[model samples]
Target chain A: MSGIQYLFPEYEVVRNDDRCIRCRVCERQCANEVHCYDEGRDKMFSDESKCVNCQRCVSLCPTRALKIVKSDCRLRENANWDSDTIREIYKQAGSGGVLLSSMGNPKPLPVYWDKILINASQVTNPSIDPLREPMETRVFLGKKPEKIVRGEDGRLVTDLPPQLELSLPVMFSAMSYGSISYNAHASLARAAAELGTCYNTGEGGLHEDFYPYGPHTIVQVASGRFGVHEDYLEAGAAIEIKMGQGAKPGIGGHLPGAKVGPDVSRTRMIPEGSDAISPAPHHDIYSIEDLRQLVWSLKEATGHRKPVIVKVAAVHNIAAIASGIARSGADILAIDGFRGGTGAAPTRIRDNVGIPVELALAAVDQRLRDEGIRSQVSLVVGGSIRSSADVVKAVALGADACYIATAAVLALGCHLCRTCQSGKCNWGIATQRPDLVKRLNPDIGSERLINLLTAWKHEIKELMGGMGINSIEALRGNRKMLRGVGLNETELRILGIAHAGE
Target chain B: MKRVYVNEEWCLGCHLCEYNCAFANSGARDMVSALKGKPLVSRIRVEGDGRITYAVSCRHCTDPLCVTCCISGALRREDGVVRIDRGKCVGCLTCVLVCPYGAVAPGPDGAALKCELCLQNSCGAPACAAGCPNRAIVYEEREEERS
Candidate 1:
């Protein structure tokens, strides 16, 4: 085999001989096959070169003897001709291919949430204790009737359209089955079911075992339209029309042939081991009017039983985009920001494209309210809503709910190694390898997810209580409670918040 | 020598480490008495903004930059744990600027507070590891280097 290495291996695995138990938990847990037992020497050895510093082997090592350290090796330090850029050059020269990266962009971008402050009641208003008062986090997302209806017989008519009722103002974002492990999907499904919230099935299609979670699932139909059928359409509580993603923006996604195992192939309704690449844009949709057509068509296909959500990336013209989406006969709009994670994407696009979710959400919400179409649809904001404070800020910025994935992954023991594309996820959340997949117990994963969300819900209640807002509805679009600290006039104008001490 | 190490994956960012550390060094019998109205400026801190969170404290580097950068002779290393002398001299923040982890910060009293491994006032194991709810923080030493 012709050997060509572009990037230096970042981690070196250290195995202790005296503490070796030979249980092979590390061997079984690693998808890269770094660890192996030599029958001739009867000893456990690791190649070390295959390590990604994911800490899978180190965490699973029974004897606690395994550790990974950053390689001290370096290329001559130059800022412009940096090691990473040089390595990329070498790799592209060798393979003549674009460098693909996984997870969110790690660049130091300005996060607007930290720049915004939430106002707490002092003398003018008294902060209510969440423990003593009822705070409503429950939300119904759909087109609400402009006014209460009255029947001809004088009996009050309660007939209304279908809405997605959430126990809290948070839900699991779309992470495809092909991108994450079966156990991860199962954990999300179980957690959503137990929490009475919804989990999205990203373009990869829904799994068969998770049909019991259909009532809490939001199935997506992307440009590729994988695993989509009449039953698949009707199986979910809501259907999402994914026009674009925040990670790649203008670019589409491609699940490699190697990741398309038997189960992923079946669920995706694609031939096994074949590359599945979604096109940049839906062939049928070229304009906002075309998007409306598709939205109504999905509504017709599902007999208008399930709400149709139009999901898009937060791009430069997001306000205009959301305005059109509001008129698209869709019930909800899901906007994912730039810091969103991906299974894999060209490194250039992930780190360089798209705007922040906070700015996009505020702009869209303001535009819709200005256009007097705010009640026409619901908005769910995602991408880097890390804490309950993030959720409260998102709601105050005019989001109906928040979608979180990275935080959910953290609850399931992910170390944020950002090696999700390697498919050797030691935590078993993002990998498909059976060995690594089995390492994550669905029961435990779901419980941890529930615990994280429950804690966040309590925190959200406290934050709302401090604002003197007893209900989430009262907090939604309540911009008076938010103030900007270090943002400029334009930034504050876009966010619709006054300066701190204003 | 045992030093405070972290498995940041298990850290829930609960900030209990800071409370326990202050209480242990406060010489107060209970937590409420030690930290009732006084805003705490603990040696160890958790630093993160949303996407990924991790605990940050003294790594006690063999050749610590903070010790070298300190002009007031306030920062020092003893027995492998980086210790701070708040009363030595000035509140110059050179160590805070030099520390890579952003672990060193100006305390409420204008003195720099950095993790001292709970050695100045305690006898038992470090209070942080003992009070960590998730056991994400631990006091341990490196494995023996193999030939």
Candidate 2:
């Protein structure tokens, strides 16, 4: 019944007549409008083709009556031409357009976090309970003063420039206001404020409502300069120059005109309904010296009050790239791995580009240490840091602190359906639609996020306590507390961690 | 009519919706008593990689393809809600074959299971939406805002 149909639906819906109470809850709850009741027949019915298997109806059926099953609609059995592969090929042949996917890459690539193991204390070093001992997770990100300088009064100089102090060693990563819903930003802002951490504005500029959270915010400057202005540059506690993103390392981003609504338009200082394209590289920043000029310009614009963070995607030569950034007068360097997420990206670029954050962090840390400039700039690593163990591992790998977006969002309730590009999210965290966006009550979102961070903070402390480490400062770059499992010599050497059971 | 809007950005990949959905429909007196490691078979599911996460559930589209492709007379629509009658179903799964969102899945008895918006489950709305700590899964009516 179709002229060149797409991939067929994969499941069927079956309702039981004997259990037909006809409450119609499925009707109201379905966003796809798959379920409807027949008045003339006085019975409930379903259009199985529209069903997404969200199970909202079956779970709420009350009568124990609804079922969805895999369709027997299989293509002829062929290993070379599987159903999904054939469908994908047909889809490409039909549309002749690149398949764009939302979120991180779905390929079963290596995840470095799972392979690295954290060290624990033994009889040599007694383990201390975080609850009973003074285990510190708080970290300050910025330049630390070197050898003490004497003043005229022969007293140590306590004059230190601006720095970001995190109660815990984690800050919400850069996620632009345009990419996520206002409520999502609200939750993050509230959590950052409550947790005494910072949240990056991710080149979307600063929203009027969030300027009040400036002290706890890190305003970003990407290639597009969508919302960059004098006041915007001076607003946040830190100014981050986004050289690249982990999701699509070498490519630029184009926020389709369709998604650029009034709020996003205003926040980004761009014309409404206009495409927001962030170019791959800033025209002004062609070299490291040019990057230096930009950093200095921002410092001059903000009166050198805020720390300047230079964020780069973790590429093959990230260590060398980071060394230049360290000397470029940047206070902090943010390394984002390939596993990072995005609102929308070409499927190919997301899956096949960039390296893992762990390796990048290790290489950068080692390079900075070898250069004897490790203390000049703080290091922050991000891109899919799942649990407290990861945070611990990152610190031991030499990260001064960690920046997280996915985990932060998860605490607020993301399910990872990978449909963010559609912008019809039911939870309201990703969509700009008022009805959907309003559903995310920032109060609850903030509360849940706070709970998650508190839990992670507690866990980080416990992990640190078990390692016989008293503070997060001591844990930084302590590769002695880490071991590699099932990794080759090169990987272990790159990570600067010995193999397990060694 | 109201619908559940997914804010995929807020989804934590926790799969709480599946557990809550399962518990809500479990007909259990308490959530823990029914779902404390009971091989969850909830109507909704979570899908994601390490970086980002979101929930997958019924979208309840306007002109459903599942209805047009059903081999049996089991699939029907009335008052804008598409539902099914197992008694009339042949379990052919033609509906699943045509659904573009991949929202449809196999049920316990090899039947189809999906999100239907809580009409009889706990809470006046949906359990997944209400119990969602992040407010990622919201139940509401769609509006003509994305032009």
Candidate 3:
């Protein structure tokens, strides 16, 4: 009872008098009962603690009439912060724990956007107008062996694995159905069909509506394996086994029961309000051999019609890891870099862990080639692939293509506020609330996404044409065509490319 | 004691809340036709500086003044939530004029509109709180009574 006063402490709005102006806007705008104008007092009176900081009064202040600030109340810094910290602090303060937030990166790390540079064609080589030349931006994603020999029957069949034929190199990455709204998933699926690429159904499994777009979907099976079944397995063009995510490296997701709506619950194969926890480690696979068992099991379950992709978070010795993945009978290997997006992850994991996609791609390509198993599997890289240059760079560095999540969301009008964790997405891109779901027009969203990929495809083809490469196959692993500028000797050596102007 | 509050610094001005609130009140089973081309004015509003935004809703004050401010007694505080009596409201606009926080607004019916805490309009919990992915509009009651 002692802290009740502190928890529901009366809010007041105090003016310094030196900055007082009777604009009367605060009186007109405040949606809380903290402020009042007593005709007897003739001055605006406020109980500051009740202010929710909606800023209505602050913005409407004609002469800067008001400022609403939180009271400077401090809790003891225990250093060992936990739920107990919150309970104890609330017990002491006597009110509900205050919710505070910050969006995007919570860790200090180098953003390669500053390190990477874009090359524009100058007077030396002619930059063709994109409207004139018919650029070929078509990209195929799958395993390409060292050789493709014809059988005695005269049919073109060899030891190469099945691949996904993408109209464009860019495709949406795995974002769980529960993590984002149904409308968002619908938009991606519709866009993938219209644009002739694919969108991944993250570990959350595919919604029933997306079954029509199954041909253009890459369904994922993570450690949790929520919606894995015979029907779910056969519903997509390719199956991706997610070893890790870019944002929350080394950690798994916990879809709080609060967010697991009835539809989400059904899709994820869990009860409503039960925490859908995904463990960091897969209970079945302990080694590369064990991984191969799961791979073959999925292949057997799906009757070998669909290509299986093993996606891993980029880490040290990734090249060695890729070599093992190749021999594991996987059709494709997807390496997620550190800068990928997630629905909800601890502030520490999203920013602190994982390696750069560029570095991981280079190492994995070199390792597989050095092991002579490069032909055994294909590679797709993700985390954050922004533009056509990233797609081209990925191809040259041994990736068959690239997977993009944030960029796809951007095409659907996401501002990258990194507030996806908040279910109140004004853009209707994230959140499962029926009201928010209505905000997204799947038809419009899908079209915009298709338009963006189509635009990027043209740009990619133009770049490839300038390099005298007619097909994506010729450009794959052609690092000689790539030269680095502003990179140190170690980076150049690792990337197996010479410095620009060398 | 459960209530809705807004933190201005984090609001992205996406306006999903408004759409959600409108849909919850629209009474349509499908969302597309209910919201596609309507002038959406929610009981709650987002207010902020040009660079930042936060949502605004009724505080459901302990001793509600809007109920008293109503000249026709159209406004009443029920179960800690402020409600408007549309049938009784004569469109005098007295409640709208006298509200200290501007929480009361003229609805389409010419009656005052304020946050009902989604007691009747919301499908489940308050749509704003249910839809807030960030757990921002928490609907938990305080444990103790005020001094």
* Candidate 1 local lDDT, A117-147, one digit each (tens): 9989999989989999888999998887777
Give chain B TM-scores in order.
0.88, 0.87, 0.86
Clashes (backbone N, CA, C under 3 Å), per candidate, total 0, 79, 19
Give candidate 2's whole-model lDDT.
Answer: 0.82
Better of 2 and 3 by lDDT: 2
**lDDT, each prediction:** 0.85, 0.82, 0.73
Candidate 3 CAPRI grade: incorrect
Residue-level error in angstroms, candidate 3, position B16 = 14
How well is each residue in B1-147 modelled by candidate 2, as lDDT tens digits?
677788876665546677678877788876555654356777777778834667877777777788788787777665665676657777777777787877777666666766667665565468888877556788877783321
Q: Candidate 1 lDDT, tens digit per residue, B1-147?
A: 777888765564546677677778788776556665466657777776633456788777877899999998888888766888899848888888998878888887788888777777763678888766445788887773221
Docking class of 1: incorrect
DockQ of 2: 0.06
Candidates sorted by lDDT, descending order? Answer: 1, 2, 3
What is the DockQ for all candidates, taken in turn? 0.01, 0.06, 0.02
Query: Which candidate tops lDDT?
Result: 1
